[model samples]
Target: VLVGRDIGTVVIPEAPIKFYIDAAPEERARRRYHELKKQGKHVPYEQVLADILRRDRIDSERDLSPLRAAEDAVRIDNTGQSAAETLAQALAILRAKFG
Candidate 1:
């Protein structure tokens, strides 16, 4: 299970199963804020949000290996879900695809 922004799109375009997991920007910012706090990093929530947006824009706009979902990738929107829930959804997709 390789995890990267461009794994499915660039590194391994022929992979059988690819999941593009996403969430709202605000939710992502909240999660990042908590993560940074857990690591003892002192950063404001608004600043974290701005950084996220800026990084997203840069990633998507970059000429090489831009961030994008592969054409055949399974898109998952886990805006308000826990990690376990997201895993369950991915597992469900695998089961349905292989069963």
Candidate 2:
């Protein structure tokens, strides 16, 4: 149940089940925008998008423990999916792998 950019890749590479959940940068920015707005933050969507892209680049290119999925990790791209849909997808993976 660990969730982080490098958890599966660096922190615990030997974990039996690892998931690399991802979404389009625009979708990620949209989610962040709504989350910030709900928290009463007045950040613009474009700014959020730029920030996300910049952070992604920095994280992926950093020399120390750069972000990456484990070779055996399950990849999930929930670009246009709701939370429940994503959960269902993960659950299905778990079921398929463990049951």
Candidate 3:
């Protein structure tokens, strides 16, 4: 399953393949802000950004199962890439791997 940092490390270590999609904290926060706004939650952008940053720190420093990429997982950074580009890259990788 595509999931959080611990999925490959703890939950499904035996899966033959894995991928991890990443983005900058600011980008992540922006996405979250829009998501909540779409849901009609009237929250400020600054608050969402602060919470996103705080969660990043906590997840990074947690003792058990700290957030980290798997040793062999494909890492995809979507910082500046568009959604279409990201999907194409991901699909290309999968096709190459399984074809």
Candidate 4:
């Protein structure tokens, strides 16, 4: 699982698998821009892109809890997939692994 700061330190029950999901900076920026616009918020694409880039840099370079996948974790790049497609893929993997 891809965990943010809050859940990273906790130990959960044993599971057979875990994965980290990520997308390219440009793709993430575009998605964020569209989501904000859909919510009737005014934000430019350039601003969203800049914010994503900045956050990406900070996440990668953070001294503690730097954003990275565990050695055994599968990494999924969801840049091109629609949300439903991504969820379907993830569910398929879970079923295959845990059934």
lDDT by residue (tens digit), candidate 2, 2-99? 88999988899999999999999999999999999999999999999999999999999999999888999999999999989999999999999899
Tens digit of lDDT per residue, candidate 3, span 4-90?
778988899878888888999889888889999999997899999999889888998999998888898899999878889998998
Q: Which model scores highest in lDDT?
A: 1
Q: Rank the candidates by lDDT, best first.
A: 1, 2, 3, 4
Clashing pairs in 1: none
Give the TM-scores of the predictions, in the order they appear: 0.97, 0.97, 0.88, 0.81
**Local distance difference test scores for all models:** 0.97, 0.95, 0.88, 0.75
User: Where does candidate 1 stray beyond 4 Å?
Assistant: none
Model 1, range 23-48, lDDT digits (tens) per residue? 99999999999999999998999999
The TM-score measured for candidate 4 stands at: 0.81
Candidate order (TM-score): 1, 2, 3, 4
* Candidate 3, number of clashes: 0
Cα RMSD to the true fold for all candidates = 0.6, 0.6, 1.6, 2.7
Question: Which is the better candidate, 3 or 4, if ranked by lDDT?
Answer: 3
What are the clashing pairs of model 2? none
